[model samples]
Target: MRYLAGNPFSAVTLPATLAPEWSLQIERALAPELLRALRESLDAHCARPGDEAAQCRIARAAIGLMVDSGLRRAEAAGARRSGVKRVDGIRGQSMWTLTLVGKRSKVRTVPASPATLDALRAH
Candidate 1:
């Protein structure tokens, strides 16, 4: 008779069912210490003298874009010089932003820090 039921477990609550529901633990961003370590490592690499130093500078710039602007990997990878725009801000100050296509092909502009912009310029 029990086998007649579509699901035998449906009629009873098993001990395993009493366990607490599991929730996903997601890390949204890097910790400050980790971020600092990463920056130091990149800077160290950039300081090295060699042909690879040029590539390191570019890598640092790309990583700077990702860290400063909250850009996704693909967005930073596809970033172009033409996409960087300078606009006038309050009190005649200059503001910089990077325009890029994000997820789902959505076009958006994100603010760029001076340090990051300088890195890009150097690269």
Candidate 2:
């Protein structure tokens, strides 16, 4: 009898469609690690004495927000004050949540760590 099984070399049974074009879409974008480290360092620069008040606050706020949200740089820029909120969830844990528009017009909810709240308060 003829072989009943499919191609032995193939791992899947797909109909042979074109591979996904992630570059042309906003679904698969990611930030480079080196740039992220640089930005974090720059944000922390404000901790130095004699730093400009406004610039430092901006940096701190930016950095802390990113760290808290675990989002890319672009997402941080789209953050809005109106979307920030403090809520007490289970176990009486209170935290700040940020709602913002992400890539591909997706809306996401991001949490702010204590550090981020402090920075926002400072400004």
* Full-model lDDT for every candidate: 0.79, 0.72
Worst 10 residues of 2 by lDDT: 17-26
**Which candidate comes out best when scored by TM-score?**
1
Model 1's TM-score against the true structure:
0.72
> What is the Cα-based TM-score of model 2?
0.59
lDDT of 2 at 21: 18
Off by over 4 Å in 2: 1-51
Estimate, for each residue in 1-123, the C-alpha lDDT of model 2 and write its tens digit.
569667775776656333321222334434569547755675666666665756878877887777656667898988889989998989998888887777666677778888778788877
**What TM-score does each of the candidates earn?**
0.72, 0.59
Quick one: best lDDT, which candidate? 1
Alpha-carbon error at 36 in model 2, in Å?
Answer: 13
Model 2, position 75: C-alpha lDDT score: 82
- Between which residue pairs do clashes occur in model 1? none
Clashing pairs counted in every model:
0, 0
